[model samples]
Target: MVRKAVLPVAGWGTRFLPATKAMPKEMFPIIDKPVIQFIVEECLEAGIENIIFVTGRHKRPIEHHFDINTDLEKHLEHAGKTEILRNIFHISRIINPIYIRQKEQLGLGHAVLVAEPVVGNEPFVVALGDVIVKDEKNVVERMIEVYQRFGKSVIAVFEVSPKEVSQYGIVSCRHIERDIYILDDLVEKPHPDEAPSNLAIVGRYLFTPTIFEKLKVTPPGKGGELQLTDAMRLVLEEEAIYAIKIKAKVYDTGTPLGYIRTLVEFALQREDLKEPLLDFLKDLLSRDIPQIHRT
Candidate 1:
């Protein structure tokens, strides 16, 4: 069973400026819960016992959110908010997370390396905190299933438009079945025409301990920071690495525009706010402003 999982939250979210200047992007909410919470729930559902968080400075809020607040708990109990108190208790009882600071702004491979002391020789899952994907069967659970069946490393993949292949790590694979591929090669951020295949590796992975060895040999690529894709390429030669196309909508909530769209989607799904939000939109669209008004 995959008992340990790692989440990297140390990146400077420069894309979501101003607001993210002080706030960690992982805490950005989707519906009523933060994106990281969703990622944690997915891990828990997959029987993950220990959550190793690779964090950095300015990420104290993420730690606080997972810590116990005696004062707040007492106050809630005194106020007689029984239901709310229970919810707080539930949140407080979540599996305690282990935090490791990554002082340097290295790449994703480096972030995974920080947890080496804790992960040691165990096969673990790495879920990117900023990318949120939801499905009926937890994404981690699905990945775990594939890992057990093949007894090898597995990565979550999605088919992206050929034109947008440069935005993700493209996977080249041999067809085994519908939505399942035998990964042959991986290329990070390849141009549209230069891509190996249309299958894009998303932000979730199930990796074997041997991956650490490959990551150690993989040199820094395009950026000074080591790219995880480079490490995966080296390991692919020895053991099997496969990709599973998940049945979920993935939200790239790390960007301002993506964040705004996620907020709107969540708001419109609420029963209490749907009518008011629709009415407001209708009013704005009915305005006398000219169609050519760019603003």
Candidate 2:
């Protein structure tokens, strides 16, 4: 059983700039809860117990988020906010949190490699810190089912546009059965004309410990970083790797635009905010706004 999950949040977040200078991008909120919190909740919901974080120097907030904040808990209890206090207690108690600081920001593949000691020889899930899937269907659970059936590592992929192929790692695979693919190759950020297929690798991955050995030999590729796609391609050589086409809407919260869009979509999903937010959006869109120049 896949009982552990690795979250890689060591990126510098240059995409979010000054705000990220003081904060990790994963700490950004979807609503009241931060993005990392949502990711942890998702993992826990999927039966993941040992929540491991491949973090950096700037990611202490993540550690603190899962850890106990006694004073805050006491204050909330004193204020008679039992519901909020229970939520805090749940966050601290439910997760088996382990944090390993990556000495330097190498790459996603390197981050997962450093987690080898904690992961041991078992299979684990690698869920990207920035991507959130509002999956009512429990996507991780589905991936686990696929793993049990095929006895091969699973990669979550979704179809992307031809123009967007350059932004992702495209996979070449043969359709095995409904939603399953036997991967043949992985090309990281290929040109539109050069892309093998539109099936882009999404944030979620399930892998055997064999990936660590492959990652060891996986040299730095684009941006002079150890590309996970390069290592995954090596895995394809040894055995068949499977892909599950995710049917849920995947949210990428790594950039400013993606972050804001995720925020709006999540807000729309809430019961209290749905009607008011929809009305606010409708009212805002119905008018012609005057452009204001920056001072």
Q: Estimate, for each residue in 194-292, the C-alpha lDDT of model 2 and write its tens digit.
A: 999999988889999889999999989878888898899898889889999877888889989999999999899899999999999888776777663
Model 1, 127: alpha-carbon shift in Å?
A: 0.3
The true-versus-predicted C-alpha distance at residue 24 of model 2, in Å, is 0.7
lDDT value, candidate 1, whole model: 0.86
| Candidate 1 wrong stretches, greater than 4 Å | 288-295
C-alpha lDDT of all candidate models, in order: 0.86, 0.90
Query: Can you write out model 1's per-residue Cα lDDT over 1-295, one digit (the tens) per residue?
Result: 7889999999999997777888899998776678888788778778886899999988988998778898999999999988977866776577669999999988999999888899989789999998878677688888888888888899999878888899899988997887677898999899898999888887999999988998889899877997899999999889889889876777888888888887887789899989999998778877887873444
lDDT (0-100) at residue 195 of candidate 2?
99
At residue 113, candidate 1 shows an lDDT of 86
